[model samples]
Target: MTYTGEVTVGGPPDTREAGDLQITKIAVGPMANNAYLLRCALTGEQVLIDAADEAPRLLELIGDGGLARVVTTHRHGDHWQALSAVVEATGAETVAGEDDADELPVPVDVRVRTGARVRVGSCELEVIEIVGHTPGSIVLAYDDPDGITHLFTGDSLFPGGVGRTWSPDDFIRLVNDVETKIFDRFDDDTWFYPGHGDDSTLGAERASVPDWRARGW
Candidate 1:
C-alpha cells in the first residue's frame, strides 16, 4: 500500500488510529521552525511534516502515533535538520520531490511530485509543487472530514504576504504562480499553515495579492 524506494535508515509501516486526524506543532531548532505531527484519525498512522531540531520534544509528542513518515517541503536544513533523531523514533520513511532528492539532508524512501497523493489511512493529501522558495518546495492540501481544505504551505504562502523568493526570478515566478495556479484553485476560506507564523486564509491573501505584488516584497 506504500511506495518503498531504496531501503533507508528508518521507516515504520503505516498503522491506523481509531480517532480523528490530529495535528500537533513542536517548535524546533534555533530558527523556531515548526515541526508538525499529523495522526490519522482512522488509523493511528502518523507522519512528521518536519524535524528541524529539539529532538527531545519531537520524540515526546510522537510517543505512540506509530510515526511512519517524515516529509520535507523543500531543501532547507531548517525544515529537516533533525532527520537522524526522528528516524530513530519512527524508523519511518522519508519523502521529498525527485528533483531535489539528491540534495536531501537524509536518505529518502519515497520521492513524490505534483498531483500525487500521500495517504494516511482514510486521509489523502494532494501535493502541489511550489518552486520559488526552493527548487523542490511543495504545498500539501487535504480535505478534512468536515470537507474543509487545509493547506500545509511549508515555506510558501503565509499570513499577510507570500514567502520571499530567495532570488529575483524565483520571486517573480512565485508571485505569478500564486495568482494563476493556487488562488484560482482554492476557495477564499481555505486555511493556510505556513512553515512559520500565524495561519491565514486564501481569501485574505487573494484580496491583498495586488498590494503584495505592488509592494514588491
Candidate 2:
C-alpha cells in the first residue's frame, strides 16, 4: 500500500521507504499524537521520534532491532508521555531541543539547536528549531537520495497552518520562521509529517501561507 501519512490510535502504522531509510508513522495517546520510527536500511539502526504513548505497542513496532535514540520535538506532555517508559526499556539516548530539554521527563542526552545533525546509521536528519508552539519546538528534515525531502514537524506546524500560539507575536514569529527556514529552503515536493493528524506537501499548502498569516494563528 502507498504511504498516506494517515493513522489512528488502534490502526496499523503507515510506512514509506526513502532511499536507505524506512519511515513509519503511528498515532498514539488520547490526543492522537503521531510517533515516527525511522530505520536505516543499511545498518538496521533505528531512531524514534516522539514516544507519545502506548509503550507496549511502540516496543512491538521496534521488535528485536532495538532503538538507538528517541527525539522529542517539543516539551509538551502529550508528545513525551511514554518517553520514560520507552527509554527505560530500550536504553536509547534521549534528544530534544536545547531550550526544552530540561522540561522532559528523561534527561536529554543530546540538546540540539538549529543546523545540528542526528544520525541513523549512514542517514542524517537536519534539525530546524521553530519557536511559538513551544520555546524550542523543532522540525527534522531528511534529504532522501532516491526521493524528495521529508520533514517531521512537531507541533510547530500542521497541514493547514502553524501550531497554536498564545500571542500575536508568537504567531508571527512562527509564520516567519516557517516561511524563511522551511518553505524557502525546501521544494514543493517536500513531504511533511506533522505531530498530529495527516501529512501534506509544501506545494499543496504553499498558497495558503498568506491566509494563515492573515488569520494570525
Candidate 3:
C-alpha cells in the first residue's frame, strides 16, 4: 500500500511490509487515534484495527480492496467512534473481546477470547486478552514466517510504560499481562502498534518494565 501527501491527522501514514503482511498506520480524529490496515499481500485480504475516526479517510485506504473485518482493541469511545460508519460503508464484520463486546454501541459479530485466532488471508493473528486498560482490552499478535512478531496493542502497552489504570490492582494486572503474555512470549524484535501514538518494539520497552512497575504506573 502506498500513500502520498498529508494524512487525516498525522504527517503521513506509516507502512511496513513484513513477509506476507502489509501494515499501514494512519492517525485519525482530534485524539490522534491510530487506525491500522493489515493486508495479506499474498491473498489481498485485509483487516482493519480501530476505526478510531474519520471514516471516509479509513475507507479511502481500503479503496476497492474491501475489508473483511474491523477489530476494536477495546470498548473506549475514541477507539470506535468511526466503527459504525465504516461497518455501514463496507459491510465488514465487527470483532471485539468477549468481556467488552456488550459495551460496544453496535452488536459485535465475533467475540474473541485470548488464544483465539483471527484469520487474515492465509495468516492468523492470535488474540491476547490483557485487562486493565479495560476489562477486556486485547492485543493481536501475528508471528510472521520470518520469525518477527507484529503486535497490535490497543491501549495496553506503550513506549515507556503500560496503559493507564485507575487502581493499583488494575495496574498490576496490566503489568503482569504485558510481562507474561507479551514480553515473555515474544522476542525483543517484536514490533507493537499502539492505539493512540507511535509504534514501539518489545526490545525497546523490555528493560523499562521493572521501572514502570516500581513506579506503579
Superposed by TM-score, candidate 1 places the C-alpha of residue 104 at a distance from the truth, in angstroms, of: 1.8
Which structure is stronger by lDDT: 2 or 3? 2
In candidate 3, what are the lDDT values of residues 100-119, reduced to their tens digit?
99998878999999989998
How would you order the candidates by lDDT, starting with the best? 2, 3, 1
Candidate 3 positional error at 36, Å? 0.5
lDDT string for model 2 (92-160, tens) is 999999999999998999999999999999999999999888889999999998799999999887899
lDDT score for candidate 3 against the true structure: 0.90
Off by over 4 Å in 1: 1-19
Q: Rank by TM-score, descending?
A: 2, 3, 1
List lDDT for all candidates, in order.
Answer: 0.73, 0.94, 0.90
* Model 2 spans > 4 angstroms off: none
lDDT of 1 by residue, 8-40 (tens): 112222222223666655555477576767888
| RMSD from true fold, candidate 3 | 2.4
Q: Please name the candidate that would achieve the greatest TM-score relative to the true structure.
A: 2
Weakest ten-residue segment in model 3 by summed lDDT: 1-10
